[model samples]
Target: MRKLAALTTLALFGLSGAALAQEVTLRAVTSFAEKTTYSRGFERFIERVNETGKGIIRINYIGGPKAMPPFEVGNALKNGVVDIANVTGAFYTNVMPEADAWKLRQVPMAEVRKNGGFDYMAAIYAQKMNAIFLANFVGDNPFHLYLNKKITGPDMAGLKLRITPVYRDFFQAQGATVVQTAPGEVYTALERGVVDGYGWPITGIFDLGWHEKTKYRVDPGFYTAEVSALVNKTTWDKLTPQQKAILQKAGEEAEKEGVAEFAKLNAEDTEKQAKAGIEAIKFDAANTKLFLDKAYEAGWAGIIRQSPEHGPKLRGFFSKAN
Candidate 1:
């Protein structure tokens, strides 16, 4: 009787361990600071997952470089160090050179949001990266010229402008000396007069306090930046069908909330920037048309010549959306 009791106890303990192993907790990382719009969306995603996951699955967010650098997020996810990450599509251009084709193409946010482009991109990302694309949030803030001195038109020929690769050629073509600088270093560069201006997302200027060093803001509305949230394939595969369903439902909820939040915050921030005394320059009709035409021509032509395979699909997607 004592031997039978011992065996039954061991069996029950083993079953308990097995049951505990089935409940999973996932880690997600992102490069956005806690105050940034991206972080807000991430918070919403986490809330949705927790509310609907029924305690079977949990997601713990690790924000910014404190967890992992923006560029390293993909590698972290793949290695199982982190189960998910949020990243800008532009940052992964090195891994998928064809990614630049998607970033550079000028597609109106409204049209892209209405069409099935987000779903299509999600599918492509999943197939290529062996991860589930959770959401594609539209960043509406345009890359603007933040200058130290007020200048009209593109004739400020000698101005040294700090820019990323996407805008490097465009700025050079406009007669500005281009200086490549990371987002974090822009303020010091501007204060020290290493560059006359920096081309950046308008929100970044405010977020990083670069607005304190600059006076003018130009709204050329050149192109939009694409940001995405992805989950690891291994982690996703391990999820039960019920868990997967919960995550998918949460992702869709986050998408709607994110789009609305971004739109509202963008408008409010623009107003705040204006009130803070930063001069806002809206390109006149002629300049707007000229800028868009030249930008599209240079951007698309360069992508097709460089990444022929993915370039055509990217062009088709943008063209249809436009």
Candidate 2:
């Protein structure tokens, strides 16, 4: 009788252990194509998570923007259509307006993580978008204006520029006519003269073939470029504590690694740009200051206008205190 009782207890314990060992799989998508430099950070994060997470959790990475439109990734997350998304804050600003502050961040993400800004931003994502604001995977690069026509300075009067939310206000502040479009449409926009130029980071022009039509890159780029990891709040809440820790740890490591790697890629892309016959249109010191001033003022003003409550707090956390 004692032996039979012990055997029954052991059998129940074995079933419980099997249940605990069942792996969690998460579906993920990126905003850019897989090979593009913009998606490299998310790729690395997925790699780290798969390797370290082991049977605890595994990310089932869906294809990049090909799987779903970039603008729709946020909605997919909100509506529980996917478990995770490797998207940019700019891409999801429709869900959380204060997200634009991320592109305007003046400090390193590591610093932001330490100074309570990271948690604050995470809270905003949860409350506003039903998502978790994971670590920023790309932030070391800055956005520059790539133009088909050479401009003497920052006076953008009468020029039509392709704009993303990342620089819409800045371009408007510089007096350019802004034309918002998807990344895939930029080539047609450029080829057909729908736009004379577009705002983009240092490394992605060639990937998008914008370098083929682009003639000049204006120097003294205004604001930083950033892409982040965003997890669906429902998915995040459902994760086991161990799985959550693994994902969080992988994000921190990937963020640090990505920032360093992308910086090197930025340097290489600069040479590639020059080799591709794209010239630089550098602004003089006075014009540089005027240009930067206009960019930031317009950027923050737009943020404040859109998000009356969270805008100033975001500025305080991300910018140097006055």
Candidate 3:
């Protein structure tokens, strides 16, 4: 009788352990194609999470644009169609216009987290988008103008270029005729002369072979790329404390790794682009000042225009304190 009772208790304990070990999978999507470093960093983040989490949490990464349009993924996350998303500020701005402040972030991601900026932005994200702000994977590598021909003077006269929200206003201020083309279409557009140039991160042009059509990179890159990860609030609230800690640790590690990796890739790829005949066009001192000044102004102008009441306060946190 004693032996049978002990065996029954052991069986119950085994069943309980199995139940606790059940895998928790989260579905995720990205705006970038798998070929892009944005998605590569994303994959690394997931790998770290799974390794440390040990089956407590697993993210099932869904396809990119094929799974959902780049602009639509944020909405999908909000509606619980996906638990997480790797999205860009350009698309996320549609859901939370204040997200544009990310473009104006003067400090590093780690610094932002340390300085209370991360939590401040996260609150706005939760309030406005009903989502959790994870981390900025595409860090520090600023956006630059890519052109087929060298840009002369401060003016972008007679240039028709592709633009993302990060630079659309700034490019327009320089007198360029801006064309909005999807990333997948940029190579074809440039090859066939649908557009003369485009603005993109200093890295990742080779992933889509855009560097083949692009010949010159304008110096003094502006605005961080603003690539970020997000989680659905409902999904976030459901996570166990341990599970949440795993994800946050993974995100923090990925954020630091991304900045270092991008710095290396930026130098190596820029050298390669130079070897392949892509020239770095440097503006004269006066034009350089004007270009940078206009870039910052245009970025802030858009933010304030979209959210007059909150823009100044939001920008204050990202910017140097007065």
Candidate 4:
């Protein structure tokens, strides 16, 4: 009868709607410009996860800083205004002070993940930042001082340096008048002589056109650049077990492969920097030891000073990692 046909049609349409509802698309943002190495690397992670997650889950990268400024992205994720984000620890230190340890710690990513380091960080993020620490994508390349003036030693006295939480203590210890500046503002600060130099990842100076202003790379780079991908805890909690497993697998794979990708790019960029006339201050044996020792001491001490209760326990992992 016509009534039976109508009922059947409604049932079919309802089933179709249900099927569409089964697919999930998470909105993600990053703390970098779209053309930068960080974005390039993170997009690859999104691609791989989307490919692996096909029907169940999809990540739509909404955009980078244009969508949400770098410093504000973490708060967006925490409040569920964003489902995911690729953010740096420096941006979220206010949300989770212990996050500074992620950038300052000397342990390699492999060891960090293998030992309890990543899980410890995940717990911290979950409890304090309202996010899940998915994985670290850009940690292979370390940070270096990109300066307009050349210096022979670690004595940064009287220089106005742009700093992030990662290098603030170490640079301050070296006597530099550290100015806290956001990544996007560094260029204007440099051009206006608001800052004499800045610290950045070994591979990304060219991305921001900073190479044009940089004349010297103070060698013996310090601290692994820890750019982490995070998922909003509310969103994470709502995922099906299978979707969670897929995301976890994708994050692990991205972390493993991203290391090699960054390594290759770092070498290429270092060469490009040399050709572009950026001088390197080569460290001799004694200077190399002195520089690393002082840098580590300054970094670890700062972390402990900020979060005494958790700091020593976390730093224990670094010693074990060695």
Q: Which residue pairs come into collision in candidate 1?
A: none
Residue by residue across 264-307, what tens digits does model 1's lDDT show?
76688778888888887667888878877776676677667766
Weakest ten-residue segment in model 4 by summed lDDT:
14-23
Worst 10-residue lDDT window for candidate 2 reads 13-22
Model 2, which residues run further than 4 Å from truth? 1-21
lDDT of each: 0.69, 0.86, 0.83, 0.84
Please provide, for model 3 over 1-322, each residue's C-alpha lDDT reduced to its tens digit, 9 standing for 90 to 100. 9988866976877666445546689998988887577788888888888788786899888868888888788788888899988888787667888886788888778778888777887888888888998878876788889998777666888899898677777888888999876687898999899888998988888888887788898987878777778999999998988888998888877778888888898888889889888999998889888888888888888889898977887677687655
TM-score of 1: 0.83
Give the per-residue lDDT digits (tens) of candidate 2, residues 59-126.
Answer: 99897878898988888998779888888777877888888888888888989988998889888888
Q: Which segments of model 1 are wrong by more than 4 Å?
A: 1-10, 14-21, 101-124, 320-322
**Of the pair 1 and 3, which is ahead by lDDT?**
3
User: How would you encode candidate 4's per-residue C-alpha lDDT over 45-71 as one tens digit per residue?
Assistant: 889889988888999999988878888
Clashing pairs in 3: none
